[model samples]
Target: MVGFLGLFAHMAVIGVDTLFAVSSLVISNAITRQIKVGIPVWFCFAFGFAFTEWSNVRACWNDGKEGIIAGSAPVFPLLCIKLLLSWMTENKEAFATRTNAGDNTTITTSATSTSSTSQTGDARKAGGDINTNSKTGDTTKTGGEKKKRHLQLVKDNPDLEYVKEKAKEFYRKNGKWPGRPTLQRIAGCRENHARNALRELKGAS
Candidate 1:
């Protein structure tokens, strides 16, 4: 009876650890944009877990003496790997594409608008009509430039269109589009692709 209880305890610990390890790998891979790397990592983790559990069971069969001893040794290492995987996954960027240009564009536009507004006081002091005309021209130019940028982003990422189409089809069939994580599973494309595609679609409509 004591041996049987120990066996059950060993199995429970191994089962929980395996669950955490597998889930960690899945989430980590999804977040890190390392889906390709993640596949092999998952397999390795699976094999490792299986091996550990087999060792524990084997030790248990011989005698209950080894059950806790064999199982405890691997638990810490598996947990540490799981923790590292979580940290790396969280810190890693989802998309590999450089978003610096997009960020710079926003900063530049903001600076330009602030400067223009500062200059507006001088223009208005000189004449109300002149200030109004200048502001209108600036607004028109800014609007045109933003439109061009958005169009370029869409043109460069044609895959975004396919994602949108697929999302719509999924929604029609399933009655709802999958969440970001599930969508990420469909293809290696990051969340940015989905977000950008949605933005473009809304703008077009």
Candidate 2:
């Protein structure tokens, strides 16, 4: 806990708007929304600055407080690296989710296109001119099929993936995954299913 708080204070002292500071804010917020719940970045920096300046007096330095004040410098680069690593891991998960969603959409669109093409051929055989009405109806039918497929995807969503995301969010806010009672509250899932989901998430597979 001390190291974490020190990291936040170190980030601010460097420069609140600097790249590392900004990245710290992003990484911190990804895990914690309420500054009160976590460390208040701006306030911590201000406090650290004030403390350092106050301790810089000749009397305080002679008392050996300067060594502690000077310790702040090294933490700056280390905290930046920590924040960047957290961001990279979170970004990877987010990107994977988007890729999965896009794949599902692509599959649905291709199905619609294939169904439309098949209907178009049938229309040409049955009439002097291809039946425009038939093509339109086929398009609508494929659209409904796509909707059903989308719903199915959600219903069949990998339980581990769903639970992992919720668990990560909960951990960010509270610094720990919920045990039995609170787990379902954060997950918004039924108790039995949540347990099953937990197994999948925790499983080797």
Models 1 onward score TM values of 0.26, 0.25
lDDT of 1 by residue, 1-205 (tens): 2244677977865665667577656755554564544566666666666655665566666556576666556645756765777676666564323466678889999999999998998787779878788999999999999988755544334487677786676667898665665554454356787677556655675
Worst 10 residues of 1 by lDDT: 149-158
Best by TM-score: 1
| Candidate 1 Cα outliers beyond 4 Å, as residue runs | 1-46, 49-97, 127-205
**Clash pairs (backbone) in predicted model 1:** none
Tell me the spans in candidate 2 whose CA falls farther than 4 Å from its real position.
1-78, 128-205
Residue 187 miss distance in model 2 (angstroms)? 99
CA shift of 205, model 2, Å = 99
Question: How many Å off is the CA of 201 in candidate 2?
Answer: 99
Q: Write down the RMSD of all candidates, one decimal each.
A: 40.3, 42.1
